[model samples]
Target chain A: MKLDSAGLQILSRHECVALLGSVPIGRIVFTDRALPAVQPVNFVLDAERLVIRTAVGSKLAAAAQDAIVAFEADEFDPGTRTGWSVTVVGSARAVREPEEIEYLAGLPLHAWAPGSRDHYIVVGTEHVTGRRLSSVDVG
Target chain B: MKLDSAGLQILSRHECVALLGSVPIGRIVFTDRALPAVQPVNFVLDAERLVIRTAVGSKLAAAAQDAIVAFEADEFDPGTRTGWSVTVVGSARAVREPEEIEYLAGLPLHAWAPGSRDHYIVVGTEHVTGRRLSSVDVG
Candidate 1:
């Protein structure tokens, strides 16, 4: 098992994808007005791609279009001080085609916020990296 | 109670800072190699600023220096579909003064990862905005 400099275990690409699929919510990082902006989102993994549904006119839908964005998901326990974080850095493109939107709508992706989320932003898994800190390795 | 377009409650600056102090962990968004990167970190709020302790030569310490960055912290309950998310967009600067570092060391901010974390990155809370979703507002 490869370990990072901080002694956390470096997760493999496959492990990263698996861990990402385990979580329903994630945070997306994009540039807004030339400054970095992060927003928590609900997403689903589809064949190594992260699909997020949001309002068509939301800031995320505008800023994330055809931009290099970062997506992160993790689960941590304060009492145990153990958790795993997976990050995917790639280009985010809004899905526009009718057939593709129909297929994506068939997925189990649902928005938690009360709104008409009609836009789909898909981020490829170009660079997938993850680190896990187990209870045994907690210092 | 101001409601965002998505029906989430818009939190005031006072409420945002209070919620930020409630969480010990947060995600920091910074630029790496001209691309956005997000990393989860252990941090503590000092008044209106966020203090992060990291290794001296880490990427976070390097990428966040004198740059605009985003810090996000939140708590969510999946079953109840309720949570609060606070985002702070501000400039990040490294704590170089020995006396200031010494003073920061006195804070209860302890690094979770096993390593010598002697570097402190302080992010100013310039534009703080937050949203809260309650169970009663669930759709």
Candidate 2:
């Protein structure tokens, strides 16, 4: 409901999660020694949990259990400088249940990073927000 | 040239910067309070400096002086599942110099966030790295 000066529409939580399903790739932001780090990963939404596959012992997998993380995805048309971006901040937990891991493996989650991507991490969408940039700014 | 098992090419510093130039939008990953936050912004790479515009009191603008940040941009085709992503990790500084602000204003840095976007911050690209997910894996 917050529209900035340019009339960029502040998307609702429902809208944010819906948009999350539209894109396959997004950046996952995490902290490394208190400094923010970002990496692009392909993800899938299983109901409300945002699932991603990372390599074993990878920086992402090694993230502290219940670590706070941020996920962002957007589809923009550079030609018109218009698009929608959604950000979800939540707690990340490793999927350790054998049954759950097997289920996630079949969820069509593709890890673009090459290697043994045997780790599954899920970020519960607690705070979802987004903005829509229109081609024509609302003056 | 560290190639991953999937044969994804590890991009060089020079190659990373070159790829960054090809995009007009990127995500500025910052820390809000004690947790990580990821927000998308329009930016322009000035040499090794990544410049972005934000509102005066926004979290991004109020980030700690010399705060470490990460900027990421990428393009992936769904059909081919191929794309490249570049990440620059460095310190962010507010662009306060009148002359500098004026010069940056003239650049094609579009601010999608509605507002005056008067505050400018520059991230010095201290460490630039990238990865290329090729449809053809070398493995």
Candidate 3:
């Protein structure tokens, strides 16, 4: 897929939503001690919000108290050197209502790691954007 | 890259370190308002430490003031349905010395987005691990 400047721009947005809808996993980015940190998380698209799961003592549970965060997901095709990335910038908050919890439970979000996996983390999108790079454009 | 139990275990560690070395950009996973949040960042590998750039009044600055964080990176091959992911769990700390800053400045990290990217966030790997998924395995 040869992406011209305009095509790259359009594909960035289209791919953003497409990747968001096709996958339930993303990277949660934030600052920890003046340094950048990222982690893989199982997420669900709740309306315009992205929701994830964590534990009580988990790092995610401690840092997201009234803070801004960045969430991202992407799909890359090495053969074609083509890929798209979508990033969501927003504040995170815990879901407390029983009804919402019940709704979230039905989603396919599961922790691939073993250990304590109990808490749920939700990132609300304040800014949503994406980008794409292709092999044809490289050479 | 079909993975048996043993292969999965070994691949996990390799994936984690490989991710740390492969990409210059990543997301920081933190907590805000009791929910999980993420942000994009430019980083460098300082030995086993993952260092990133940041600034004051940034969400990362607020999140890393004294909390645990999860850092991650990955490369996935959708055609073969195989990919590897690595995650680092650790505490975040600020880089205070001028010499350290100068050393970090010499690394190959660059920001993909335009913004105030001055502060440096460094997350040391207290624990590092990864996983690989493949459709075929020889052993």
What lDDT tens digits, residue by residue, belong to model 2 across residues B1-139?
6785445789998899899988878888887887787778878888678988888887778763578888898988877778998888888898888999999888877675556787889998878888888753211
Tens digit per residue, CA lDDT, model 1, A22-101: 98799999998988999999899998899999998899999998999999999988887889999999999999999999
Displacement of the residue A64 alpha carbon in candidate 1, Å: 1.2
TM-scores of chain A across the candidates, in order, are 0.96, 0.91, 0.82
How much is B111 displaced in model 3, in angstroms?
Answer: 1.9
lDDT assessment of candidate 3: 0.66
True contacts kept of each: 0.61, 0.58, 0.16
Tens-digit per-residue lDDT, B1-139, candidate 1:
9999877899999999999999889999999988899999999998678999989889999999999899999998888778999999999999999999999998888777777888999999879999998834332
Better of 2 and 3 by DockQ: 2
> What's the TM for model 1?
0.96
Predictions' DockQ, in order:
0.60, 0.54, 0.14
**Cα lDDT of model 3 by residue, B49-137, tens digit:** 88887665566777886578876777654354356677777888877788887887777665443344556678887687676644332
TM-score of each: 0.96, 0.92, 0.57
- The top-ranked prediction according to TM-score is 1
Which is better, 1 or 2, measured by DockQ? 1
* Residue-level error in angstroms, candidate 3, position A3: 23
Ranking by lDDT: 1, 2, 3
